[model samples]
Target: MIKRQAREEDETHTAVQGCLRDLGKSLGYDVWIAANDRNRPLDGGKLGDGCLGELPAAVGQAPGADAVRLIDVLWLAKETGRIVAAFEVEHTTSIYSGIVRMLDLALGPEAHALEGMFLVAPDGREGEVKAQLARPAFSRIADLKVHYLPYGELKANREAIARFGEGMKPIQAIARNLV
Candidate 1:
């Protein structure tokens, strides 16, 4: 039962990642899938197959490159390689890790310029997410304004947003500001 539940959770996370990938592309950003998650089939090919072979800027410039690499999804500016937004889908995994990854990106040299950072999880997890964010260790994340996007919300509007949305505004509208 535990194994089955874990598998289902992983599938949900993957589906969320795939939706983010599609939305990023539709909004004209080059999407990057985590190196480990690249193997998962999404759309017509592997998730990482559709992503850039390398980060526009080497993610390893900072000490958190390893953590940053596994960020569920990243929307980067195609020409400049600047990360426009970073997302971590916390389906059933540790929210602590997701927040930590956001911190890695937030503490990077270009932190101030990032357009957005988000934690995407199940709708019911909002209270858990809020409580976790309240922890002292996540102080920096709170300051950085990590947003929350529920799975149901993403799934509900992704198609319309993909087809008609002009830029990040549509996504932002759906994402709840965590802090």
Candidate 2:
């Protein structure tokens, strides 16, 4: 049962990442899936979502580039090439690792005014995510205004938003404020 549950969670994680990638692309931002996840099947294509071969010059040259590259998904501004948003689908894994990865990009040499830094996870885990962010070690995350994107919310509205949503506004509306 435990193993089956784990597999289920992993599938959800991949799905959420795929949803985010599609949403970002439709909203006119370039999407990127984590390097390790690129080959995973998603949305009729691999999880890489046909992303750029490398991180944009803006983030690629910044410190912690390696860590930032591993963030579950990113939405880059079309013109500036800056990362407008970063997401880590926590699913059933350690939220701590996701937060750490977000922090790496947030605190990197380049000052990124991310439109949203989200932890996409199961709705039941909201409290766990809040507890982790409340820790002193992750204090900056609060300042960064990291948010929680419940899988239910994303899965439910992803299609409508993709067709009619403008920019990140619609996506932000679905996310819960954790700061």
Candidate 3:
């Protein structure tokens, strides 16, 4: 049962990534999915920081706040020449409050680096999550975007899934979608 659940999680994660890639393509951006467990040497091996130790304090502070860190998907908006829009996907039935806290940390810095920050959830709870983000504390943060894509949307988009699952080459799939 444990292994089966793990496999399900893997499938879910991959589907989320595929949806993201499709969305990025539709928006004319390049998408790169970060490795699930391999953190860059910098940022103390944090998943999002690409440079070794040069990331701002905001990016590194969330771990201590009990936030669950997942692989960060980076998107480069071609029109803006900006890179590193970090996104997180949540499929857990019970919402994790720490995720909002972590977004506060990650977005502060990522907003400056990329076009915007996005939180993708498939459980139909995006409005509530966006409301939480709209609080004054998180409002001042620039270029933050919230979107919710139902699992049905993903399943309906067979071309995108095939492109994403063709291999481990998600980046290539994203590039193809752009063209």
What is the per-residue lDDT of model 3 for residues 3-48, given as tens digits with 9 covering 90 to 100? Answer: 9997787667555665565555554555555544334233244333
**For residues 1-179, what per-residue lDDT tens digits would candidate 1 score against the true structure?**
99999888877788889889989999999999988898987666787766777775555566787888889999988777778899999987779887877788888865765888999999999988988888888877767888999988898999899999976899899999876
Descending-TM-score candidate ranking: 1, 2, 3
Would you estimate the TM-scores of all the predictions?
0.93, 0.92, 0.47
Residue 28 deviation, candidate 2, in Å? Answer: 0.7
Stretches off by above 4 angstroms in model 3 are 22-27, 37-71, 78-81, 93-116, 124-145, 154-179
Candidates, ranked, lDDT: 2, 1, 3
Off by over 4 Å in 2: 1-3
RMSD of each: 1.5, 1.6, 9.4
- Which lDDT tens digits does candidate 2 get at residues 136-167? 88888777888899988998999899999988
Q: Candidates' lDDT values, in order? A: 0.85, 0.85, 0.47
Hey, what RMSD does candidate 2 come out at?
A: 1.6
Best by TM-score: 1
Steric clashes per prediction: 0, 0, 3
Show the lowest summed lDDT stretch of 10 residues, model 3. Answer: 170-179
